[model samples]
Target: MEWFKVVAFVVCVLPTAHCASDAIVWCYHLPSCNDKTWPTISPQYCNGSRQSPINIVSASATPNNNLTKFTFVKYDDTSAMTSIENTGDTVKVTFKSGVKISGGDLSEQYDSLQFHLHWGNGSSVPGSEHTVDGKRYPMELHIVNSKSSYNGNTSLAVKDSTGLAALGFFIEVREAAHEMI
Candidate 1:
């Protein structure tokens, strides 16, 4: 099995009450709230150095022997995925608990929370949030997981640096096999 090539990007939007992100609505696609002003959408996350690593230079990646195979629990259960919606910026999928993931050098198992797809809002735009060799993929998928130790309490998970994981997968169109020959 192909191990998770990219594991974990800290998520920083949990609150003690009423859910963390319920209060603020971020306009991610607008020029007024682009990259430079993204932090304005959530200033609370900027005070620390522990949020998501927005991007990574693949060429600079270091090989780790430890990030081995991962065991997926209940990934096939369609019921695990509870909801899906368009948040204006991206399409997000919510999970119904029980699905979990382990191995991949993790000291403990992580609960599979949800996943979202990153694709162009329009046919003319590039969709993927990440790039390979300076080119963006047609689409991308981010699977968010939180350490089970937190007991589904996102408020607690957001504080720990290693409490959350964001697995990313780039979707690409395959070339015709006969054409290759």
Candidate 2:
């Protein structure tokens, strides 16, 4: 009975294993791994069904009139842009009043809240979701905002991934700069 069971298990598994094909693998490019510089690594798997990268070759690619544009207006209050300082793994930023970002499909005017930087431990890696030309930037800034424009309202835009929009700035910090936090 034991011999029959083993034979049955193998018979059922062997064909399925043979019929399975490889899968497209995705990986993040980080600045460092295990406190050391991140090494160039290839994807773990490759298969024929993998999707190809799209490149718009048409020169006529233009913005449609129906498309909403998000306008980032520079407020005269320099204080809104200040107060950004790196603290270990995180960077904090504060915005002053009269600073507003509008346009696009925004249902309400967004007011700046505490923003932070998310990045890998090294220079080579970028800690963000979207990559440019498969290359990672050194750091990514997440300028968090609130749609309600009021504090202690329990309306954190960051809490809802689909409900909020984030302005991501990919930066390469090569030198130190004085800023507020």
Candidate 3:
């Protein structure tokens, strides 16, 4: 009789544990960027004194052979607005249809769907990479792309890593900028 009760309890509780949704929990010791506070210290911002400064020189410059050099003029434009949403610990930005990035040694024009930032949740230390004087950058921005021949089927490419091409840019947070939460 006791064994039957124990088996019943286990069966009842097991499904509940597995049914819970998986979510990324961000531990914020400071206020987040979306918080409506006045100049509060955020874990995403690094103060000037406690941060690592990046120094660049002209001698170590190398031209990018894989990237397309096109002027992106729709940083704040609404027409270029794509789908921006939070995915786990990172925020994803997807561009509108027919927004193409070209001008490199490639035969096909790559479409810009979205750009996302992968960062650590602390000041003076971001979860990214940057390069200075031929060194790797502390933070890197990945501009994910797919072949334009697919006709705006980037979602299908994301499912397959081989079908996707990504361009990375290293950046550092100098001051308190608008955080894309």
Number of clashing residue pairs in every model?
3, 5, 14
- In candidate 3, what are the lDDT values of residues 77-163, reduced to their tens digit? 677865888876578888877666554444456666787765664554444432355443334566655657777784554444233
Of the two candidates 2 and 3, the one with more favorable TM-score, higher being better, is 3
Better of 1 and 2 by TM-score: 1
Residue range with the least summed lDDT across 10 consecutive positions in model 3: 4-13
Model 3, CA-based lDDT:
0.46
lDDT of 1: 0.65
Model 2: CA > 4 A from native: 1-66, 81-85, 119-129, 149-163, 172-181
Question: What are the per-residue Cα lDDT tens digits for candidate 1 across 1-181?
Answer: 2222232332232222211356666443456764346466677643334343245567787776877687899999867788899877688988888899887766689998989877764455556665655666666788888899999996677666567766777776554445433
Question: Against the true structure, whose lDDT is highest?
Answer: 1
**Total clashing pairs in model 2:** 5
What are the root-mean-square deviations of the candidates from the true structure over C-alphas?
Answer: 5.8, 19.7, 20.4
Looking at candidate 2, the ten consecutive residues that score lowest on lDDT are 4-13
Q: State which candidate, 1 or 3, has the greater TM-score.
A: 1
How do these models rank on lDDT, best leading? 1, 3, 2
The TM-score ranking, best first, is: 1, 3, 2
The best candidate in terms of TM-score: 1
